[model samples]
Target: MTETFTVTVEPLEREVECRADQPILDACLRAGVWLPHACTHGTCGTCKVEVLDGDVEHNDASDFALMEFERNEGKTLTCVATPTSDVIIEADVEVEEGVVHHPVQDFAGRLVSIEDVARQTRRLVIDLDREMAFNPGQYVTIEVPGTDATRTYSMANPPSEPGRIELQIRRTPGGLATDGWIFKDLGAGETLRLSGPYGRFFLREARTAPAILIGGGTGLAPLKSIVRHVLEGGLAHRLYLYQGARMQADLYDVDFFRGLEADHPEQFTYRPCLSDEEWDGPHGLVTDVVDADFPTCRKHMAYLCGPPPMVEAALKTLMRKRLFPRDIYREDFFDASDKATGGVRSPLLKA
Candidate 1:
């Protein structure tokens, strides 16, 4: 028997139905209602909402995402909360005008090919059944065929074109998806299930403030999308991109970024940093470069995407440089395999 529930969103007077065993966010997506969310696994606080009415069951979620006070105040992460009955929830759903348009899509995709972008990263190109409308910085969850495991990867393709989706994936040691493919090999024409166009990490057009983008490893994936959007839209504001890797070879798309700087001679700047390499472009951690360049981050809007440690460290440095916490936007990339295999702990969860 299928159970049905109702969700009433405040101020907007919008109501949606929730099906049994489905997350509230998933139900919203099915009903064409877009909500801010990242890492649908109850990590990022983007999908947080106030449960104004009814009872709901949620899986174990990170306290950092929804604190004890917030929870006591009837707040919950909509991504992992399943409605037990009729429910009413309130969230901020206003999409800023002129920003990228993102919609949920259920499209069939076939893996066309995979090319090694670097020793640790591979670029996967997927051909979808139809064009998926998504902003450059949005992400999709790829469900491993015949398994319950799914991994979220950012779309590196430009929003202007959508039929094909591109993903930059880093091979996590002992990761089921990466490890299995590494040794067994996967051929073309393998079908995989995908859903989304999720995330609010896309560029905001109204803000003409000077911008700084920081990325690490595969975190560069979404930043690449935003840069392409900015260039294509002809936004003339100054833009600085800093990408850091362990060594020279780890800087996968240095040429691609350099091309952007060359094309928009006056508008863009590119700095590639190596954390532990002999050669020099920019040395030390990526955050150190930001601190050196922008001593006083008074009017800059910063976008950071990367591993948790990098994101945390950069946040501290940005704060120290006088950057307002609200002016900084970030998407922390969590490796599912690393968490599952005990390789690394999610700092967000740790906090």
Candidate 2:
């Protein structure tokens, strides 16, 4: 028999059973209690909860998410922690009134196609067994068959299409998932298991401010979804998309983005930037480009998704332009450093 413990959630006054081998957040989701979470691997710190009593063990939490002070204050990341005993936790537990909270569902999907759009980036489209509904900027965690490991990728396409989702994955040289499985062996018609519609990085409805969407490398995936969502809804907020790459060839999906701009010329603006190589268009870091264009971002809502360094630099630039922390939403998917921190960066392996 498997060891199991009860988790008591305060404020909501709910209780759920967690297996010894599974994270607490997973248990909560399995019980249909949708707690907010971004990176379920413990890098993002979005699923933090205060332990009111009992003991919890950190399985694979990163220092970035669970700091020493936070740990001392009885805080734990539910996504990476399994309870050693029956525990009581305090967390922000509320379901949006009108929004349907889609609990995590096991989905089987066959790889429809994988085409190289850039030198090291591949665009993959999968047709699922059943229709999956997700908001813009949500991601799915795919189970690597024959292993306990899983990899996450944000949706590059919107939910306008039923039973399908697109992803743009950057090649990770020797990664277990990217190189070992996805690159070396994954083939069309191969069935894969995935679960989610995870993350709180989606677009906020009923916004009147102009939106600025920034992306780097494979981070363009979620931004692509956001842009398409806005366009499809015929929302009239001025939208600016700034996609940055190290070299010219690193840029992809230019024709599609250009087509969006052409259709909504007055509302949409596309700016593709290059940092390492000299380009006739914009030639600088993405943060520098944003600094030059929007000197004052008092009335702007910024959404950024990219490597950690790029997202950090852009955050500073946005703050300098007078944008409040609440006005700027970010999803830092990768760590660009050579450190073995598990992130979306190339060769980013999770132990």
Candidate 3:
């Protein structure tokens, strides 16, 4: 027999049944309730909540954003906590309503092509028989055939067009999905299963401030989609794209971004930086470049997508320069292989 428990979530008075082994956040997701979360593995503190009344069993998720005092007061990270009995919890979590869009049609798609963009990064284009509508910055979970493993990748393609999606994947040594399947032996016409257009990392149309986009390595995947959408929409806000790589070889699609900047000189600027390269162009870390160029970030809206280290560094730099956390958006790309190889470390969790 499967163990089940009832969970009452306050502020919305929503109740849902959760399996004894399932995390509260996963239950909420299945129940069609949206919650603010990043790095679902007990880090980033985006899913912290207070337990008003209930008996629950959960491992310490100090890394998930809960202070010791809060944890002592019955606070828990919903993504890692499992209820032992009927429970009531209170949170200020934002729940997205309506059906979520996905890039794969009904969780199935065929890999139509894979193009090498760099030495370690490749762009995989998958074609689906049916349309998969998704916001540009949202990502999908791909399950490679013949394995129980899965990996999440942001769709480089925009939602305005459907029936196909593009993903830029970075190969990690010993990564089962990235190194084993995607990078080594995966080929065209292969079938892959996918789910979700999940993530709250998409660009917000409400802000009209001059925008700053920061991306590192393959994190440029979603940033590219946002820039394309902004350019295509012809939004009048001034936009600047700052992409950082260790060397010039890691930077891809320079001509595409250059064309965008040329077409909209008054509204767009593209700056590619090589942190450790011998180039005469912009040098040093990407956030450092942002700091030197724009000292006051108060009037700017920033969208950051990248590795945890770069994201944390950029966040600190932005906050120090007067940009509000609410005005900044980010997507933390978690390495799924860490779960398998025990090598993935989240900076947010450490904080």
Candidate 4:
């Protein structure tokens, strides 16, 4: 058996046994340490931590995420680093009063159904053995059948439905999880091993400002969760959702959101933008459309999710429109392919 090493988490002063090959972030989160992380596959630098003592093996971390200079300076991506000896790591730990930090847990899920939602996207409905407590915008890592590889997808359904969740997945041309499995022979009633409530991309309820949610393609998954949460809980803040897609065929659930807008006409607004084709709503990039709609986004909270290009574009637009960086939250949906191409972000936008 491989020996386990003791990992001491700073500030919390807690110790946990980490398997020889386990990522430091995994060990910490499973131990309820809750280190801030996004895109847990090591492409995003959100899990970067300082190793105060001992050594670690940085495995498969993107050079952009954990640069050579940073590696030499004792910085490592906890999601890809494994402790080679007993060590202590100082993680960025913050506390927000209204946010609930749900402990991560594993569950066996049964695929209930999957149907084409858009041209290259599918909506997957999964039923878990037990309820999973996760904040809106959090995701789960699912172990691919017939392989040890895992893929993370955000829960599109709100937290109210704890035992069941919905996911909006866009098929990647030759992705291991997409083309290799999820879009292949995978069928209903198949058993899937998953673990979650990962990522800090959830709603920030403490702020009372109106929310501007922007999502590109399948990135709408988590934003759907936040919208449902607000509408269900009867939250007072107004919500504006902007969905960006290439064309009408790339858009899904347009009627569903229209129905929601009809129900809450005074509180919710949905804008669907199609860049490649003409549409009744908007005709340009989602960020450009939003920039035109809201001349100034003073005191408004922004939630952005999508490919790095879209997310960064929205961030720039929001900041330029006078939204504070502290009020803008974003989650970049990075795949392994992005690691090589690189999408290194400013540490100031770290969240």
Tens digit of per-residue lDDT, candidate 2, span 1-351: 889999999878889999988899989987878787877887767788999999999877787567789999999999989999999999976565445666777799989998889978888899999988787888899997788878889998887875898999988877768877787778888898998788777877666599999999998999999899889888777889999899989999999999999999999999999999996889899889989998699989998997777887888899889998778878877432222453433222111
Candidate 4 lDDT tens digits, 1-351: 987999998978989889889998898888887888888998888899899998999998998888899999999999889999999999888878888888788999999998988898999999999999989899999998788778999999999999999999999998999898888888999998999989999998888799999999998999999999999889887999999999999999899899999999999999999999986879999999999999899979999998888999999999999998889989898987888867647555562
Q: How close is candidate 3 to the true structure, as a TM-score?
A: 0.83
Local accuracy of candidate 3 as per-residue lDDT tens digits, 19-50 = 98878877886676666566655655667888
Best by lDDT: 4
lDDT of 2 at 29: 81
Per-residue lDDT tens digits for candidate 1, residues 261-341, read: 999988899999988986859898999988998869988988888887798788889888888877787888866533334
RMSD of 2: 3.8
Model 3 lDDT, residue 236, Cα: 69
Query: Relative to the true structure, how large is the alpha-carbon lDDT of every model?
Result: 0.80, 0.83, 0.79, 0.90
Q: Count the backbone clashes (under 3 Å) in each candidate.
A: 0, 0, 0, 0
Model 4 poorest 10 in a row by lDDT: 342-351
Candidate 4 whole-model C-alpha lDDT, 0 to 1: 0.90
For candidate 1, the 10 contiguous residues with the lowest summed lDDT are 342-351
TM-score of 1: 0.90
Q: What does candidate 4 score on TM?
A: 0.97
- Count of clashing pairs, candidate 3: 0
Candidate order by decreasing TM-score:
4, 2, 1, 3
For residue 216, model 3's alpha carbon misses the true position, in angstroms, by 0.3
TM-scores, in order shown?
0.90, 0.91, 0.83, 0.97
